[model samples]
Target: MIRLSNSVVLQDEELDITAIRAQGAGGQHVNKTSTAIHLRFNIQQSSLPEHYKARLLAATHHLITEDGVIIIKSQSYRSQQMNKDAAISRLVTLIRELTREEKNRKSTKPTRKSVERRLDNKNKHSIVKTLRSKVRRFFE
Candidate 1:
């Protein structure tokens, strides 16, 4: 079981790990060994809370498949074990992010002083424009 938080625990069976060839660096070793890890978890099938699932889907649309599986690939490490661990760590991090509640933004109106200052600036700009205009000599 993977403990995401104090309340959230993920079952081991939920995660599907596959080993694939790592891309970039290591020359011959990279071409031969299947060191990269591909971790797939079905978000809709998981025991996670409905709200968390919804937020996870919304936040991680790129990671999710059309069939509702979350795909995470890791090739940073040389060994398959290291890549697997890295992938799982990423999954936990993503889950934690989804679970954390966003702080509600307080709706605030512009202060009276700020509004007055803005209007004052506009009036000053208008006055400056008026002075720059070519005055027509009506007597001419």
Candidate 2:
């Protein structure tokens, strides 16, 4: 079983791990060895709370497939075991992120002093523009 957090635990069978060849830079070694791990977990099918499932699905549209599977590929490590562990850690991290509750923001109106300051600035600007206008003098 994978323990996501203090409150959430997922069955071991829920994760599907596949070993695929790592991509980039390593040349033949990268092409030959399947060190990279591809991990897929079905969020909708898991035993997570309804709210957690909903939040995860909503937050990760790119990571989750159309069929509702969350896919994570881990290949930074050279060994297959390391890659596999990395994949599991990534999964745990992603699920753990869902556990946090966003603090509610209170809507606030502009302060009276701020409004007054803004009007003062505008009035000063208008006075400066009036002073810059062409002036005329009459002669008898």
Indicate which candidate wins on lDDT: 1
TM-score per candidate, in order? 0.81, 0.77
lDDT of 2 by residue, 1-140 (tens): 88876877999888999999888889656667899999999989899999888888777557678777889999898999999988898888877776568899999999999999999999999999999999867775
Residue 12, model 2: lDDT of 83
Q: Candidate 1: list runs displaced more than 4 Å.
A: 25-28, 57-60, 98-100, 138-140
lDDT of 1 by residue, 1-140 (tens): 99987888899999999999877768755677899999999989898888888877777467777777889999998878989989999999877876689799999999999999999999999999999999988996
Of candidate 2, the 10-residue stretch with the lowest lDDT total is 59-68
- Candidate maximizing TM-score: 1
lDDT of 1 at 8: 80
Provide the lowest-lDDT 10-residue window in model 1. 23-32
Alpha-carbon local distance difference test for all models: 0.87, 0.86
